[model samples]
Target: MIQLQSSAMQDTQLVSNMMYFYSNSARSSNGRQSWILLLPDLITQSRQQTRVAVLATSMLLLAIQSREERIFVESLGYYCQALISIRRQLPLVTDPQNPDFLPLTCVAIVLSFFEALCGTLFNGYYQHVQGAVVLLQIQGPRNCALVPYHSLFYAVRNHAICASLMTGKISPLAGEPWLTIPFSLSKKSSSDLVNDILLAMPRYLSALNADETASETSRMSREDIVQDLMNHLQNLAGIWSQISQHEHPIAESTQPTIPQSVELTQRYTYDNPYHAKVIANYRTAHLLAFSLLSIILPCHDWDVAPFLDDSASILSAAGYLEECDIGCAYFQMVFPLRLVAQHSPCATRRRVAIDMLKRWCGEKPVRGLANSALEAIYRGQCVIPQSPVYRNVYPDMSTEHSKACCERPVPKPFSYTAKGQWIKLDGMDTYITGDTKAQRAVLWVYDIFGFSSQILRGADILAHSSKEPILVIIPDWFRGSTAELSWVPPVTEEQQQKLGTFIQTKASAAIVVPHVRTFAKCVKAVYPRIQRLGIFGFCWGGKLVSLACQGDALFDVAAQTSPARVDPEEAKHVTVPMALLVSGDEDAGLVARYAENIRAETHVEMFPSQIHGWMSARGDLNRLVVWNEYQRGYQVIVQFFDKYL
Candidate 1:
C-alpha cells in the first residue's frame, strides 16, 4: 500500500488505478457528462480535504478490487481522516464563490458512493447526498450550467433521486427550479430527459404513501394523484417509443413478439449495450408507475398482460446486455433489473432477474451496495403494498401504524400439524375425522396452499358438529405439490414467480379438476354407508368445487369460500344447492353474476373486510378478527351442508 503523501497522489500506479476505476466503475458508458471525468483534474487542484476524500474513495475501490484486508484497513484510516476534514471545511465552503465549494461538493458525492460501497452504512449514502443536495441548492441552479459545475450538478441530481427513491421521500431537488434552471443553458441528454420526468414523481409518491396520521384535507385526492401517475406512465412510454423509433427504426417496424419465458429474444438489435441500457431504464420506470397504479386503484381491473409484457421486455434487454459482457453496461442495467425483480408479476421473469442480479454481485464494482439491495429484496421489503417506489425504505412509527391498519400480513400463518388422522381412501391419503357411520359426508378440497393445518382444523370443526355429526374426508389432491408457505404473499421475485408457476402448472383447473373428480369417486366408493354427499372448497379449491358441481353426480350440495374464477356460465350447470362465501379480494361483480345465473338454491355471503384465502390456508390465526371470520366461514359451510346434504 502506498503511504499517504503528496508524492503518492502523483504515483503512476495509483493514478492509473484511479483512472481505471472511474472509467469502468464510476461513470456510465456516456462519459461526456459524467462527473467522474473531472476527478483527475480535481485531484491535482483541490484543497487538502477534497484531495483526501478522493484518495479515500480510490483506496476503498482498490481494496474492493484486490480483496486485501490490509488495503481495506488502510482505506478505513484515510476515510475517517477524510470525514473529519470534510466536517472542518464544510462550514467555510458554503458560498459558491468559495474555492473549495465545487471540490467539496464533489467530495461529498464521492463519500456518498463510498458509503454505498460499505453497505453497512445504510443511511450514510443518503445523508451525504442530502448534504450535497444542499450545497447544490446554495450554488444556485444557474451557476451549475458551467463546465465542472454542470457535471457536479448532474451527479448530485442523480444521487438525490436515488436517495429519494430508496427512502420514499420527495427529492429536495424535485421542484421546478432545479429541473428547468439547470438544463436551461445546456440541452439535456436522452437519459437526462428520462430522469427529468422521474424527478417529478417523488412528490406524488410521498403524497400517495402518506400515513393515516396525515390529515385528510392535507392530502391530494387519490383520484387526482392516480391521474398524474397515469400521465407519467404514458409519458414514459412515449419516451421509450421515441427511443425505439430513433435507435432501431427497421426493427421497430414490426411488433416484437412478447416474451413468455426467461430466454433472451433478439427482438431488437443494439449497436451497443448503452442503447439497451436506456430502453430497460425507461421500461422499468413505466412498469413501476403502473405497479403503483394497480395497488392504489384496485377497481380498474387493469389487464396484467401489458404489465407482464414490459417485464418480459426488461428481461430481454437485460439478458441481451449480459450476453454483450460489458461490465459497465451491466451496472447500468442494475436499477432496471432490480425493478423487474421487485415489481414484475411474472414468476419466470422475476426468477431470471434475481438470478442475473445474484450473478452480478460478484462481478460488479459496488458489490457491498448490491448485496445490501439484494438483502432488502430477499426480506420482501420491496413488494410491500406501495413498494418498489418505496424500495428499501424502512417504515417509521407512523408508516407502520398505517400499514398495520390496512395491509395484509405477508406469509399468512400456516399451522404445521393437523388434528385429524391421515388415512387412505382407496389409495389416496385423506384426512379423515368425525363419525364414519353418519348419513352425510363432505369431500374437503384445499386451496393452492394444500393441506395446511388451518384448513384441516376447519374440516375438524365442521366434522365434529355435536347435533348432526357428518363424515369428513380431505384427500391430498395436490399430492405434496402444494404452494409453499414462502410464496404466500409472494414478496420476492423468485417467490412471486414460483407462486405464478405453481398456479398455472400445478393448481390450474385443467390439471386439478380431473384429480378432484377422481378423488370424489374414490371417497364415495370407500364410504358406501353415506346416504348423501357434499363438497366444500377454499380458494383455488373453491374454483374446482364450482367446476365439479356442474351436473356432477357425486355431490348432493356444494359450498366454497374465497373462490377463484367464479364464472357465471358454469353456475347455470350447478345441479345442487351452492353457497358462496367470499372475501374482499374477489370480484363482487362476478360473484353477483354467478348468483344471478345459478339455477340451484343459492346462498351468497361476502366478508368484505377479509382478504382472499381468509377461510383457508392463508388466514392469520393470530389476528382475533381473522380468527373470528375463519370460524364463521366454517360455521356457514356446516349449516349449508346440513340444510342440503
Candidate 2:
C-alpha cells in the first residue's frame, strides 16, 4: 500500500508539471505565469483530499486539450470521482474558519476553468463563478493577499462580467462586498486598468436593465449610476491611453520589426504576443464603453462615429493578435467582439468579427465560449419577430408566422414590357428597367416574389420621377424561387411549413445580404456611368436594403417599404439617409422606435389606410386608396433619392 501510494504521488507530480507547462506555453506565457507558479504551493498546502481534487481537475483540463481521446476519457472519469469527493467535503470547505477553505476556493476556480474549457452552457459557467464568489466572500478582502490571489480574483471577476453580458444576467460577483475589494491602480498594468473598466460593466448593464422596472425616481437614480460608470470607464480609458503612449512611443512602435521565420506549430515563441494582447484589450475596453454609452443614450442624441472608429481599431488589433498567436489569449475579448459583430452595422467589420470568432474557435475548440459567441452572431443575423414590419404584419403571430409571410407570394398584375429587358448579370437573370445610360442607378431589391410586373412598373415609376435619369436595376436576388401571386392566403399546415422552411433556408438575412452585396458590385461595374447609387427593397427586400446601407458606401441612399426583418440592433449601424414607408395598419410604435434609432437623416411616411404588401401586391393596385398610397410612397422614394443621391 505504501509503494502504491508512492507510485500515485509520482504520477500526480508528473501530471502537475505537464499541466503547468501546457498552461504557460499553449494558453498564455506572461498572463498565466503567476497562476502557474503558485499552483504547487496551493496544492501542497491543501488538505489531502482537496489536493487530489485540484490535481484531478488540472489533469482534466490538460486532457481536454490533449490529442489523445482515451486519455481525455480517463481524466474525465478521475475528475468526476474528485468532484464527488469534493461535494462530500463541501460543508467543511464552506466554513470560513476552516483551514481547507482557501484551498477549496482555488479548486473551485479551477473547476470553473474546466467548465469554461469544455464550453459548458452559459449557466454552467455562471454556477461555478457563483461558487468561486462565495469562496472569495468567505476569504474576504482583509485576508486576500495580492500576489497569488490577485490573478484568480481578476479572472473570476472577468468571467462573471463576461457571462453576465453574454446572458444579460447580473453576475453575483458584481454586487457590494465583491466590488469593494481594492484593485490597486498604482502598480497595475494597462491591461489591469482595462479589466477594472470591464469589471464595472455588469453593474452598469444591471442598472440599465432594472431601470425599466424601477419607479421614475429610482429610474433616475439608476440612470445616474450608469452615467457615472460610463464616466469612470472614460477616465480609465484615458489613463490607459496615456500609459500605452508613454510605454510604446509612435516612432519606436511603428518601426517595422524584422520578420522571423516561424513554424505553424511554434508560433507562440514570438516575444510581442503579450504586447499585442494588451493593445487589443485596451482597444476592446474603449469599444465596450462606447457601445454601452450608445445603448444608454438615444440614437439621435449620440454620435456613433467614435464607436465606429473604435470598432475599426479593435479589428486592427485583433488582426495583429491573430498574427501573434494570442488571438484567444483573453476570453474577455469574446463579449466585446460579439458586440462589435452585432452592432457595427458595417458588413465588412461585422464579417471580420465573425471570422475572428471562427478563428478563435479553431484555435481553442476546447474553450466552448467561442461557440457561444458564434451563436450570438447567428442570432443577430437571423430574422426575428421583433422587427417593426414583422410585428406590424403579424402582430399576434409567432416568429414562425412572420417567417411564413415572407414566403407567401404577392400577385403580378401587370405584364413585363419590352422596355424592361431580362438580362443575365453575373450568371444570374436580372430584370432591368429605367434608362441604361443614366448617371444615377437604383438597385431595386425585390422581395420573395422575385421579378414581377408590379415591381418592375414601380421601378419605372421611380425612374421617371427621378430628377436625373436613373437606371433602376432589379436583380433576382432570390435566384428563381419566387412565390406566385395568389388572391387567397395559403392556410394549409403543409404550405405554412414549406414557407417556413423556405424562409429559413433561402430568405434568411444571412443568405440574402451576401448576394445583395455581390449583385450591387456587379451592377456598379456593369454601369460605370452610375456615379451615385441608391437601393430600395420591399418587404423581405427591405431587410436587404437596410443591410446594404449598414457599412458599405456603395449606396448613397436607401429606402425600405414595408421592410421585414430589420433587426433594431443592426439598424443602428446605418449612416446613409433612409426613407421608411409603411402602412398605417402596421406597428407604428415599432416603426417610430426604429426610425429614432437610425443615425442618419430619416423620413418615415405612414399610409394609415393601406395594408401590408400594398406596394408590391397587384391585388392592392385595384384598390383606389391603396393605389394612391403607393403613388405617394413612390413619390417619397423619388424625392429621397433626388435629395440624397
Candidate 3:
C-alpha cells in the first residue's frame, strides 16, 4: 500500500469486485472459470474491441458499486467506443473460420450485459442480445463445443432466451440443433435442462398469441396449440414432482445470516445452491405453464388454482438461494421471483417476494434494472378507467359492430416515401419533419396502428404547411407493439378479445400520458427555440392527448380526432385551448358534453361523413373523398395551432 498508485488501485479494485460478484454466483462449473470470470484473462489477450468491452463492463460494475456519476460516465464512454470498434470490425469477422470470430462474439455478449444492467431504453438490453444471436447463428452451434466458445455460448444462451421473452419472439436457440448440439460433447447440467424447458415457453406463448389474432387460413387450431402446451405442462409438472421427492437437508452452519426483514420459509432448505435453483426454476416453469393454459383455454378445466399453492414454495426456495454462500445466485432467480410477485394468488407471499426484491435492489446495482422492468410491467397492467361513453353508452361492442358503427374502412397499403427522417427523441424513435429551426412545434400522437403511412403523411403535411411551416414530431409511442390490422376487423372471436385486451393493456392512457409529457418536456429542452408546443392525437392517441392537455400541461394547445374514452367530467379541468374533430362513428352526444365542459378557447367540428380513424390509420387516401377530408383535417390542425401556439 505504501507505493500504490491510485489509478492502479482503482483498476485492481474494479476487477476484484467484478470477480467477487460474478464468480460467486452458483454457475455450472465445467472445471474452468465462467466466461464472466474470464474477463481478467480476456483483458490481456483479447483484441482492442473485446478488451474495451471488458473494461466497460468492469467500469460499469464499479459505477454501480460506488454510485458515482463520473464513473458511470466513464463506463458509457468505453461502451460506445467498444460498440463503434465492433461495428467496424464485424464484416471482417463474418467468416466463423476467422481468428477474430470468437472475440467479436465475446464483445457482443459483453455489450449486451452492460445494456441489461443499465440501458436507458427498454429495448437496449435485448436488442443487443438479438445482434449476438445473429452472430451465434452464423458461427453455428457445433463450433460452440470448443473451450472459450462453449463458455461464451453458455453465457449468451440465457440472454437469448430472455430476449425472446421480452420481444415475444421465438429464440433461434429454441431449435433442436442448438439445444442438443452444444451439449453433444458433454452432458447438460441441471440449469441447462431447466433453461431448455424455459426456452419453449416463449415459442409456445408467441404461437398462441399470434393464433389469437391470425386469420382462419393462417391460424393454428386452438386445439393443436392447447395440446402442445399441455404436453409441456405435463413435463414441467413431472419435473416438479420428482424434485419434490428429494430431501435437501439444510446445513445451518453454512447458511449466511439473512436480514431480519426477509424471513425464509421452512420448505426444505438445501446445502447445494444448484439444487435450490433447480427446484425454484422448475416450480416457476410449472406455474408459468399453468398460467399459459388458463390464457389459452380460459376454461374451468385448465384453472390455475391448483398451481397457486407452489407460489409460496417458489419464494421460499428463492429466499434460501439468495441467502446462500453464493450470494449472486439470486440473479438467476430474478425471473422466477418476479413471476411469483406478479402471478402469485396469495397476497402475503407476493408482498414477501416484493420485499425481497426491494432488499436485493438496495444491495446490488444490477437488481435496479430488473426491478425497473418489473415495475414498468406493473404500470402497464393498470388499466385507466374508461369514460361513461365507453362504459354505458355502447360498451362491449363486437368488432363487426364497431366497424359498422364507425364506418371503418379496410386499411390498404399505400406507398409514400416520407419527406422527413426518423430520429430519437427522449430515447424513442421519433418522426421529425418541417422547419427544425421553427419556434413553434406540434407533437403528433398517432392512432393505435403506430407510425402508419397515413399518420406520417399527416405529420409531413402539418410540418410543411405553406403559410405556417413549423416542426412536427411524431414519437413512436407504442415501441412497435401496435394493434394488428387483423384485430381491427377481428373476424374471429379470439381476435375480438385480443383487440379489447390491447386497448386495455398496451394503449392504456395511464401508461402512455406520462411518457407524452416527458417527451414534450424533452422536446422543449432540446429545442430551446421552441417557445410553444401543441399536441394532437388520433383515435387512441387522442385520449392521451386529451389527458396530456389538462392541468398546467406542457402543451400550449391540444387537438383530438375521434378520441376514444371521451370523458366530459375530466374535460372540465382543461387548462389550455382545445379542439376536437369528431368522427361520424363517435357519439356526438358525448363529444358535445365534453366540449361543453372545457373551460378554454375550444373548437369542435363534426366530421359526420368520416369514420373514427379516417385522418390517420383507417383512411384510404387514394380515394378522392378520403384524400380531400384528410387534407382538410391537417389544414384545420395547422390553422388551430397557428392561432394558439
Worst lDDT run of 10 residues, candidate 1, spans 396-405
lDDT of 3 at 586: 79
* Model 2 C-alpha lDDT per residue in residues 1-645, reported as the tens digit of each score: 112157457556644654554343233333444344455676666666556656655555555545556655765665676677777887666566787766676667666655655654455556767777777777675454355566667656656666666776556565545554545422555665566666666555555655466766324454686577578766866766654542231232343231221111111112355555555566666665655665555343555455556565556545544454331354556766676666554545666677777766765532567776775455332211121211223232211123334333455466546367778998888877779999888888776666665687788888777888888888777677865444124455345445555565677878888888887888889898888888888877887788778876878888988767445566688888889887654566666767788889999988777666677753357667767877888888889898988
lDDT of each: 0.70, 0.62, 0.70
TM-score on alpha carbons, each prediction? 0.58, 0.55, 0.56
lDDT of 3 by residue, 128-168 (tens): 78778888888899988777788778777877765665445
User: How big is the positional error of residue 82 in model 1, measured in Å on the Cα after superposition?
Assistant: 1.7
Better of 1 and 2 by lDDT: 1
Across 14-89, the per-residue lDDT of candidate 1 in tens digits comes to 5457666555433444465567666777777877777777777677777776777787787778788888888887
lDDT of 1 at 145: 79
Model 3 TM-score relative to the real fold: 0.56
Q: List the candidate 2 regions with Cα displacement exceeding 4 Å.
A: 1-33, 41-66, 146-148, 172-189, 211-230, 246-271, 299-303, 322-328, 381-645
CA error at residue 420 for candidate 2, angstroms:
30
Which of 2 and 3 is ahead in lDDT? Answer: 3
The positional error of residue 640 in candidate 2, measured at the CA in angstroms, is: 26
